[model samples]
Target chain A: MALSIAGAGRNALTEKAAWFSESLARGLKVARAFDRDQPKMRISEVAAKTGMTRASARRYLLTLKSLGYVGSENEWFYPLPRILELGYAFVSSARLEEFVEPILQRLSEATDAAAHFAVFDNNETLCLGSVFSQKLFGFFISIGARQPAYAGSMGKVLLAGLSDTKLEEYLASVRRVAHTKETVTSAAILRREITEVREQGYALNRGEMTPGIVGVAVPVRNKDGTVASVVNANWISTSSIKAAEIKRCLGPLREAAKQIEMRLASGAVPTGWVSRER
Target chain B: MALSIAGAGRNALTEKAAWFSESLARGLKVARAFDRDQPKMRISEVAAKTGMTRASARRYLLTLKSLGYVGSENEWFYPLPRILELGYAFVSSARLEEFVEPILQRLSEATDAAAHFAVFDNNETLCLGSVFSQKLFGFFISIGARQPAYAGSMGKVLLAGLSDTKLEEYLASVRRVAHTKETVTSAAILRREITEVREQGYALNRGEMTPGIVGVAVPVRNKDGTVASVVNANWISTSSIKAAEIKRCLGPLREAAKQIEMRLASGAVPTGWVSRER
Candidate 1:
């Protein structure tokens, strides 16, 4: 998947301006190179993953260490606490959490499931808010976790609500890697599913992202009817009542979406604050 | 607070390596310049906060905008969704969430109050895990949030666990800004409270961080008897049973800490994994 991910826009960084610093971009990438799968990376691994030479990667990593962004044990590098300031500034700066959180509580309680609110960030789904489920065997994720758009229910819902041009850009940029047996890895199949979501006004996932976990979602529209976010309720499906769960969740899910829209329209959510979900 | 924050190591960046690129560090700083109170910044404000020259700040901010890290409304710069990736990487990479979360849930259930686990992140306390209270008016904070080492209860416990040398470094590095009227701004007073925490084996706060917010925290230790992290239970003290509440929560809180320590000592959490949570 060398060319597969890199060419497919595996996770886009904003296009550099004429004056944009490539070193800065690489530095941020070095910071991000440490995640759930590889919390610590050897300098060579960082060099390979970031596509930087060993010397370049070492310099960046060492600089990050001095800046308190990177911590090391032997040769492996991991992020430190000060790194949280970057993402915290992003979410709280939007102030979307305040209004979206109460709605998340209501939606989660009413449906008795974990709820998530996410917006489109470049080519991936950026989770802005999450309320944990009461179920012992539920899918739990943090607010800042990112997932691909074509595979996850929240991603599909947000993608379905995008404008024609934005949708085309997203489809063109996405990597159709199969995450599970149920994942739609073909761009044509995904496009069809997204179209159906646009028509049906909701999106549903049955083990597409994570096997045995089902998710149902809807788009939250801004006053201008543009998609501000996609909110979802997820559960672990050990039983056979998949249809029943979807049927039960859609009503509250849509209701919560409307409440969010009403609040957004009422000016509690600033107009033009959130860009297009993409 | 122009020179105040910059000189105080406001948002520390690693010092430049002999070959490290300062532009990368400045670029990351440009992304963080946007926050709740100043979500949108004019060009001058960016230069002022980052201490970059006007032309340099504009170039970095423009570069961040092109990269989708920042957004613009006319001339003001705001952070976009991409910034979430930074903090998210830090928390998930540690994987402490899985082990620490259940303890938080159990503790919250036992006390019917908010429960949190934090670790020493340099001079600040980084909240590793949190289970929100069912109370509508409880003190709610997301995981990965940071508080000063001298002010909050969790900060005090973590700081108290440090060695003499490390403690001296922290005391010297910390800026004792008074957030609340009751905040301990004097170095002598803070040192005394931290020493008391070491003696008593826990730390307590009454309207220190926030006027009506009271917090009680204890340190979580590893097998070798070094502190791994600090855990706290907090509530809104609208009622007068502050003394009784602390006493009631202490047993369950300490038990939760032991449970966490046992888990950490049991090899579920990798040794040499959390090197800096001293």
Candidate 2:
């Protein structure tokens, strides 16, 4: 079958060369045209946004529609819920949520603050799961949102887990643009902060990612003791819940992380990580 | 760009033809391969399940990965949280959740029963949004899951909204396989039930889909008075909440559905409908 041929050929060095060909690149950009701010677009709008011809935009949009990732009505185009299957499949199969959701829910109930689980994706940290607290004015971390690895509590926790050489390389790739006055913009400052996070077994960010958002995070370790992920609790700065208050919740947080680690160690895969070659 | 080929040199007929081509068919299967039961799969698993070669799966996976829908590490694949962007983009842009979520949340809070918002996807009803009740042991409904349009409360509500001819066509397509003893199997019986639902402006499913699970649902109309969707509240028989108790919550549900209609009328586009023409 063409599928086997494609699969066997993927590992070949020559296949990598063909993989990045213009057609695939164009196809990707077409898919990227859909985002939170602009979920629906007309054919002309798609063409303008994607910098492709109207004819081309229509083709890609129709192709995507046929693929069930894109949907349309009249002349306006929009994405579909089935598109989530792609991502949900990755996360659910790994049992990441099964391992972590209960923990986060329990932590939220205990700490009365929003709890989040995040993992590193390239140079940024992406929220994988979150359980919002009952408080009216608390952390509102949207799942799938990204934050730089040097400023937010979740980011720092994930950064602290990275190998030193990889960390250095990442730091060099992107400028430490300050998100707020409290954000550490210097590489030296962030490096030191990450090192301290590794030493203290936790990370704290006070209004760095967003004003009034303060969070404390602890690393979730694998059986090998490598930091596999980070879990955090977020609260508002006005709640009198300073870093110390966040620290107070660390016991339960650590316990939850340990529980998740045990589950993952028991052969439950982490969410979003699918074993392909095996 | 090659994207232009999707729509170029094609009239409406050819465009429709392109919608069902082998490439698009394979892509749809790949997308469908991710579901609640199997959220993530290895390349070989995807290949096996979708009848594609591992190479074909890799290409599609890599293509999706580059588009930020899929993420990979060490040859292990997983879905990214950003993939929710697709589902959210569809739901949010359609403005269905803006009105529906608050209402569902309120209903769940009021009755302490699980509430869900669903819409017709061809012959099936797909969950667009959901809110679990504060009470324990309520029915569980996950976003993006699909159910037969002839069985569940939400499904009946949507079916009641369909044009008579379309409804008849759909009824004829199913084998009326009983999921539970209470499930309606005869076309004559189902047609009668649907007529009653249309007349009463609501639908009820008493242990039709899952034994001991009872649900009540109402149709949500769009600005044009077309049945745009349905909202349902479900409870277990053990809860002692009879179908009447569920029906009492319809006032709030209808109010929320109206709000959703208003939002959609104000310019929210439905996100899941595929265009007949490319």
Candidate 3:
């Protein structure tokens, strides 16, 4: 499996604690087994995917259904809208949406592109908040959207924030896909690009994830100088003027990052656990 | 105490099954304990809030921390952004945001007010999607935002959809707080308003939730004629002309609801479990 359990490398005492509930972990894993690709699954498929017994999977699904997180019809089970509360619990508590959204709105409107703030999660770019350009007929990336860490600009910027050993482990484990002809699938090239992003303080993507889309991203650093999150903007790529467009967005994206950094430092946004320091 | 388990009234066999994981439920309940009001909590507070023994609460918290769903500093624990994946699993699987956001955008643009689509979630209005008014200075309601069912226009519209027994149970259990001077605290008054909403096929609120906001909502029905969701719009209340302003928005809000219903029936938006059938 390309996706490993998050935080599996935590210190030994925590993992071996008698208080740890394996059932809770397994249940959560079952709930997460559904995504864009497999929105609905039978108990057997879930068991196979999560490497759990069918009986165990059935119990988890039924429990989720009882909790209103999963809905079942016959043998197929899918997640329900009520499941959003789990994510909402975090977003609302952190109050990140209130603090970061207006900045994204302004950034999107000014750049004439979709603006997003994302964080690194299990070797993927997890979009925490997003704002669409006022211009009609644009792409959509909803909050909680995830993308491969090796391809898109936001993903690369987040990857650049990781420690060297963590970065190497990610590159070694991730199953890379060539989403477009321009996507860099080689680990060596990805390492080099990430190094450049680290030096330049920004990452740029031109038709890497999607054709004809220019993505620019910069890290939003914490007070302690660790990358807390990444702020990004996406433009519809024009073959003749891609560089100019990317250049135009960098100023706003960096400024937005600084604004977010200022907010994070102000103590109003409680991102207590978002610091990725190992 | 007002927030009961979402589907606690289900049939017997599912509850008695040996496969059900009580630890998972308790852990999820612990995670949910941290909200806007209590963003960070100590072990004793968690135990007190969730009605669990401190030892049990400690186990769940440690388990969650290990899974990366939670972070702790000293004795206080808060949810991490990674916790969002639990909710994103459902949102991405349903693809509701992609389908409904454009509709909300158009509604917000036309009405010059914040537009939202919501459903009844445990006696609260759960905003599934939202779009803010482009007029630059307006309210913000993020997706997963919840409001009391007895207060807001959307809440009334959703309450009107519930069965007689369900409605009675909800009224009996909910602890209503008057958010503003105009807020209705009397159960009899709320019942009258909800009955009127059912008859009129729409709901209107003037400074009920917030002092300066006027909210209008209409139900979106499924093919089976069950209320699947509610679409609503909010305008800044002009005291003397509130009635006329709400009247103007009714046409657009009802139209938006119809559009959502049409799209839902077209099979493009799969709302498998949203039918709210008893």
Candidate 4:
């Protein structure tokens, strides 16, 4: 089906799309080559990762540079801050704050932990908004950060929100690699866990995605009662604060999620309502 | 020269040029149509703003959407969060933060006010980052927001850092619109203010940009002693916290800026330092 669509697009753009045709694939690859770990790249580095010629990579880099999306200093190329404007534009305008951010903030303050609001994109989860606790030693995940959907507390909650058929298809496709010793790598185990998550109306992860990190997540439903996103609070566990304490934190987390759902239902979810359409 | 360049660009593309001429312009226009204020737009809105047909806008939107740079929901479109990956890719990786964010954060804390770090971009000033004090009543400006270089404390500080010739040219080109009652509008007054700001090692705004707000700013110097950006702290003046209090806050603000400068000299800036690059 994907091949047929590509073939049809090719036929449709034969004469007019030639300029973009060659660079489109290379551009997408170039964008993917940039990540939190490897943000800046040399022409050679980009070429190696994207499997493009150095010359092609250079062209794309220069093009991006001219567009003010990339910066070059002393021969090393890096993505520039203007790129954040794109994300900020969406998130800031999306009125998510009216519904989501305050709830996340209150949850973080209540639990004294980092709280995150995340949505599913394909098989991965993207953190849309986040609030950091005042505590010095809490989970500090940057906004716009991504993680696999099968692993963490918020990821599992979002995954559970999917239809059973879609969830099964996703499980079949994923490798379910263990992130920590306690991570559920088996598809059957994950399926059962997601079922429980759905039944209990929340999900929990203890040292699953990251060591010493414990979290509980609940889905934020939309006006139609469909799950829109997952809100999670993460904290570092010591002997003083065990899994049970973390579970106790879930009550405020769920309350905050419910509040956000009510805000969304009231149509107060900010002007840039991209999540609703997605 | 500009007209000649435009004419040359209008000429036929080289055989190496891959995309259709109109498609390239349409794509660029679609990308440009999004700004800090209007980050998301419907297809008809984009068409209206870019002066392109809805079909052309849809084509560009689909192309960008496929690349993961643009996103859409229920026919409403927005730039995506990954767009920040580009800007942050450069800033997070750059040494700019060694002398920027820390100073701003410390200044904010010391003053119990809001501190901003901004850099010059052409004729405007772009906010690199800001740190707000724990106090509830502080200025709320995001990291990527832009302001006219001729107005505001940070803007004037950055303007003072420019070369004399460039400063003269920019001053000639700018439209000195008054933002508040105390805004400096006359060229002679502004020139004198800039000169004083240069000599005093800081700039002060007494309710110039926004009424009831007072700001003090100092330039952050790079390793080569060139002014890289400006750091400013903002506070509200009432009977309790007068202008004297605001001026007193500059002491710690300057010390913080100096510490950041030392960090920049030591080249100890963190990896993945994304902030406003341009």
Candidate 5:
């Protein structure tokens, strides 16, 4: 991404954005510094993480602190709830959260399992919305967590939606490593699984990505029948799940996917509709 | 808030933050224009909503489009998922999510009802985390959704946590309109309810905020014996709720609150430990 930005001449997107207020980007970067791994950062630490000098970091931190985005305590600084407005804008604008949220919650409530809606971005499954059941303890999953697309049921359902050539290209380039004893390691076996998933209209995974966790996924399609995302349900236990147990979820999961498809047809998705419709 | 900001002199927090990046704030304002009511907007609409000139709004929109913060479809523009990084920072930074999440899910799983953790912010309750049940169609509520502090069980629990002076002053200024026929409109009645809540250690309400919902909230305290937030469970239906049903939830709700208090004492809350602990 940086290479493309640098290679482009004047009037490039990055150059134009940085033309007026560079501090805007800097302030945003300061806000971006906090994430799951490093939620709290010291003044010196922000400087190191973002490659800004200590003075520059301090000035921006002080600016953000005043702006209500950054909250300071002793030497450590963290973000406050107001920062969520930024994210809320995206969720509201896209209108994805409104439609997917209730469906996922309902599925979780019905099955007593963790339910999720994930989109295939780049090569990973980005969890957009999730409702976890506390049957045991849930895995460390949160909204926006990315999982490998090659080793899970949700990813497989998404992969099955791709055209033949794209699917073949993905299989050729993707790293085929076993995440667990039950993971499919060979390209040939994964290709067969994807084919089966396409025929069955769902994917079932038994301890593939994480040990002791089983998953089932179905594809949510656009009006044109192209896949937009995947709806997944996960059970966190090593006990072998009977086929009937996994089958019991198929009807509700497909119902949700169809409802999402219907909603997407009515201009409820993030990816533009009217333009594509026209 | 605006008066205090204007009264402060040069180098005040707000002033310093605004000095370098006024347009940044304007861009943020434009992004916030998208909400549940209006998820899409045109350039002219954006200008009207944010009071930015068409030319300036165009520039920032173009910059955001290039920066991947905004997506354009037809003539309307909307925010993209990249904005979520801003809010994800706060959720991660506090680290409260790691502990509170499991307990909320457990409560929801057990009760088959919506369970939420809300903190008193301004004159409202800001939902920090929630696990919703699919028992009935839920109202449009999100993680950051705020409810009036005078109208709901969650709000009353937080209000009951305040000191005598603060509570009196809050009651004096707050606009108390009846949200439902059963809402406590009289300040004296509400005060008595809060006092009873303080004595019993929890609050229960039926058809107070929404017409058909029954709610019970318990206060989660810090080690210093101050209330930090409220844990709430809501049952949806117009059916009259008996005192015993509300009573049944208290034991589990209080248990979860105590668990949260224990976790908060072990360095779990967002506020800096040294300052708050002191």
Candidate 6:
């Protein structure tokens, strides 16, 4: 059956494009609007966040609930674990374990630190995969965890990968939170840090986001030489011992990133799974 | 801005519902249709698998591409990393780490085995969280990994949690593949095994799914007294040493399950994150 959205009044991108489904786009927005800060939200909360009418948000939430992707109790609505099927669909389809998992595991083992591989998502860096070394503090890396662009080594490396225009746009749009006393919330300072990350081909953070954890990250590049993902190894250290730890982890982190880059360049990863845009 | 589907035919459940967005439902189906086996699919393939016409599939895929959730290479369409946001939204909203992560970590450390917490999803058991002990085998449990209901201790415990009628229907419908010679593929045998699991309050498997691994699992129950999730600990063992390992792990698995059950019952976890259905 043919579907039409003649006057749905969506964004110009979908409005101008033929065969676009505004309903689908809006539904996904509603699904994503419920995050850690607002796990269970009302229709009005969703509408306010997603810029959809309350009626539109209600329809999408109810539809998702019926599909088992969402659940509701009284006026509160929240996502179900079944919603993970969507992410797993990508993780499984990408078969990231075959390439990224082993590398992270090996890196973690070698450096005695937690290792992670992450990609840029929205304005944050999202961990697509991670391996917890457990040798340091009980710092368990949660998959799908996010860190702001100005806070972590991996985040700065990811921000460095963006084009100047995009990076500027991101810095202008993002609200920089002071996660720790060391967090750089100034856009000008973050821009300088990202610039240094680009030149050095690595980024280092000394408890900027989370205290006592020092991280060293290097970018994994695609065949086109653009950053596809960032691989990092982090350790728990005192201020006095931080420099030696960073120095110790940097070589292995860079080596692992190069291995991952070579794998991507060798055409082992699916084309669709690689970072195609900033 | 009222939209009506007066003539568009869908399943009776959705057809009878008010304020249900069919476009949204169909769009999610198209997204989930790309899994490990069919990472990248042609329009015709997606159409046939999702039971939509080629034109409809094309529209959904294109719309998803525009939204950065799906990517296309020539005639093939595949999901993007952005799709993980949908799953992460649920994961972040659920905040499962507060109860499940530390418990799994402790269980793994105590048993010296890899530990995982999984829930029933469709016909398979989906691992929602896990911890690697790095002691027994280098067997890393990937989150979002799925196992057949008849194959693993965790899967069997989940299957046993089903009502008799639902269990019967599931056994009838599932394609039971023999992952190993020891795997029970016979429906009658599986039914008997599930019955024993229901009686025993736990399940054990000796190399059924992976020939070298022995696993024991116990169900974590919801406030309603139904199984919410299954906690498992597994070790690499030969057939000769399997029974001892299973016995060793069973106690900790049960204890961990109890802790998780208490956490769930105490309303410590968000209500929307709990298993409201089998």
lDDT, candidates in the order shown:
0.78, 0.69, 0.83, 0.69, 0.75, 0.82
Q: What class would a CAPRI assessor give candidate 3's docking? A: medium
Model 4 / residue B244 / CA error / Å: 4.1
Per-residue accuracy of model 5 over B1-278 as CA lDDT, tens digit each: 87766677544755565444675666667767777676777899888888989877777776666566677978888776556656777776666457788888677756667888877765677777777665645653456666788888898988898888878878888888888898997889999999999999888877788898988889998777888888988878678777877877887788888888888787765663211111
Worst 10 residues of 1 chain A by lDDT: A9-18
Real contacts retained, model 5: 0.46
Model 5 scores a C-alpha lDDT of 0.75
Identify the CAPRI category of the predicted complex in candidate 2.
acceptable
lDDT of 1 by residue, B37-131 (tens): 78788999999999999999988888777667777878777777777887877778766567777788778878877889887776777777877
lDDT per residue as tens, model 3, A65-137: 8898888878889988788888888889988668888899888877888889988887788888887666744
Candidate 2 lDDT over residue span A1-278, tens digit each: 99988888768757565443334445446665766577778989989998989887777787777666677779878776555454445445555445566677677777777788877765677676765554523345544556788888888988888788878887888778778888998889889999999899998878887877887889988766777778888888754346568668898789878877787687676444311211
Model 1: lDDT of residue B157: 86
List the lowest-lDDT window of 10 residues for candidate 3 chain A.
A1-10
Off by over 4 Å in 6: A1-17, A238-241, A272-278, B1-17, B136-138, B272-278
Models 1 onward score TM values of 0.87, 0.79, 0.91, 0.81, 0.84, 0.90
Leading candidate by TM-score: 3
Q: lDDT by residue for model 1 over A8-110, one digit each (tens)?
A: 5534534434576778878877888887788789999999998999998998998888777787778778787668878878766767557677778778877
Alpha-carbon interface RMSD for all candidates, in angstroms: 2.2, 4.2, 1.3, 4.8, 2.9, 1.6
TM-score of 5: 0.84
Give the alpha carbon lDDT tens digit for every residue of B1-278 in model 3: 33344456444446565667898899999988889999999999999999999999999999899898899888889998889889888778778677788888888877888888988877688888887666644567788778887888888888899888888888889999999888898889889988999998888877788778877889999888888889988867557236676678878887888888888898764456463532
Question: What's the DockQ for every one of the candidates?
Answer: 0.56, 0.28, 0.68, 0.29, 0.47, 0.64
How much is the lDDT of residue B17 in candidate 5? 56
Top-lDDT candidate index: 3
**In candidate 4, how many clashes are counted?**
17
Instruction: For residues A217-264, write the lDDT of model 5, one tens digit per residue.
Output: 899887777788888888887686678878888877888788777887
